[model samples]
Target: MAQKRSIFEEVGTNEVSKPAPQGGLIEKGRKGARKGIRAWLVVIFALVMTMIAVGGLTRLTDSGLSITEWKPVTGAVPPMNEAAWVAEFEKYQQIPEYVLQNEGMSLSEFKSIYWWEWGHRQLGRVIGLVWALGYAGFALARKVPTGWHKRLLFIGVLGGLQGAIGWWMVSSGLVGERLDVASYRLATHLGLAFVILGFIAWYVFLLGRSEAELLQARRNKDAKLFSMSTGMLHFAFLQILLGALVAGIDAGRGYTDWPLMGGQVLPPDPFYIEPLWRNFFENPALVQFIHRVAGYLLFAFGVVTWLKGRKSANKATAGAFNLMGALLFFQVVLGIVTVLHGAPLALGLAHQLGAVALFVAISRARFLSQFPKSQSVREGL
Candidate 1:
């Protein structure tokens, strides 16, 4: 029989050809995985924002003290039985807030606050799980880029530290004669949450850039934008700390009017009981007034930044600029409404959410401003 022609020869080809499309498919797969990772990071950031908002609610509703103990593991599982509920309630009764502020509160009344605290804790658990699973998958699968690994790892560490700080803040209340957490500690805890958020926003901004473009941008526009952005971020953070102080002192309860406190430009004798130094943190009127002043300053800064961004040709900068302006306006409105409503649950939560939105917007603007015009936008005009 004639020699059987090989398949390559039969097909009129001199050499066996490797499949070219396979390489393309692999490249495409890699790209897809990268996009997925970035998208997931955005999701994680959103969850963190949610956690912060809920935490604010936990504070505003006076529910943070509802759970006297910080049993991180056991706290995950809420009361399953009637006896368990009573045990939880009994523990709360020992706290000064329950004894003094809620003397006549019933089990059902207690459960109402309990659920808010429970939900807040549960959200934290979910965030932890999501971060762990997503991070592990990214690491093992080699999906995250080499540059982001260190920074992302840092963020993860911060996330863990935030949890510890949260517990530390709670622990303060359990020991002191005071029924509530200290304003300073509360500020630190909430401030760290914003820090985590700012880091994520910065990382996302970096990921959005191509390596070559980022390198060029680093030499040109990064410094100015970075400085301004950093300033805004710091200012925003301080504003949050002030707000936390206001909440810690229950200052919102005292000042229900806007543009003035109790029908006056400033409330009378804001620091009547204590040394002048203590007024900033201890006096309800002073604390609230300080938060209000911070709001005005934040609004002014946001507007100025947005205007500067408008003068630039970069779309990212412009978007960030507009975002900050819009968020600031809404936040200011929300703040006034919250005060007018006696800080109702819904409006208070809205105010907190507005603050987070403003932070994200300001962060993005800062990130974009740091990039060169060409890197932020396609070159050619």
Candidate 2:
């Protein structure tokens, strides 16, 4: 009964809109756009940085083995009363550190060192809790970017392993005649900390831009600068591990001289320690000497990398590298001062902090080399 349509009329001109084809390209823009995650990571980054500084202080103060136990949960609630504190001190007394080094320490003195170690562990616990809460909140709210699930997961795993490794390091000194944690184990623990820090940094960089922007920037990536910076990064990390070794043995307090070790170009009895290889780890003079030589080499390489960075057309990228160069110089000066002062608690902590800043600076420059942001100047209008 409806009027017949005209012969020229279009058929079904208004097509039905099917629900967004069920994924694929339709989901690309909607996925992985959580910018807040980057800020959260930055918070965690700052906390970890502070943790490292506190750890340096703990080592310098000789408070590392105060707890003598790894009660991860129960340890968080410190002794609330004098009796409890005495109980804690009794436990510490059983450890070799207290027996050998702190045999005559009073309960008050024991409490001082105990607090330092306790705070260090408490900081670790806080960091882990922060990561757990943030990751959970983000995942539950569906805010995490695509491809980041595993990356975040890996960090959590590393943190757990780090706790275990920390206990392992502590356990090393609890038995035997050792006065402190094994130098090798300390280096391992510190190296993993840096590794975790580096990953967080790289993640923050990636989250700084949209996926599309990163893809576009990749097209103009400076291969040469990136390559050199990568080398610089590896070299710097190696230097960090070496520095940890020096710290483990209190090597910086060994030779207060700059150009020489107690007036000799090489440290006296550099290989006097037994087992040959043990000298590198246990000998303060040798460890400090190796650290100095490694620093020189690292600085030279940084110079070469900085030169390459200067050639970048992106102003920001070039500036990043220039800053790195300045930090390298500053860090060197700090290290020299730290050594001259016999690695006093304050100066040692400052020097360690300088290393942290320099490492972060180089990392930033390396990132810019890979994803340089172009600067546009208007032509003569």
Highest lDDT scorer: 2
Off by over 4 Å in 2: 1-33, 377-381
lDDT of all the models against the reference? 0.80, 0.88
- Count of clashes, each model: 0, 0
Which residue segments of model 1 deviate by more than 4 Å? 1-33, 216-225, 372-381
Q: What's the true lDDT of residue 96 in model 2?
A: 83
Residue-by-residue lDDT tens digits, candidate 2, 21-122: 554463475455457888888998998888888888888898999988899999899999999999988988998888888898999999899889999999
The ten-residue window of minimal lDDT in model 1 covers 23-32
TM-score of each: 0.86, 0.91
Clashing pairs in 2: none
Can you list the residue pairs that collide in candidate 1? Answer: none
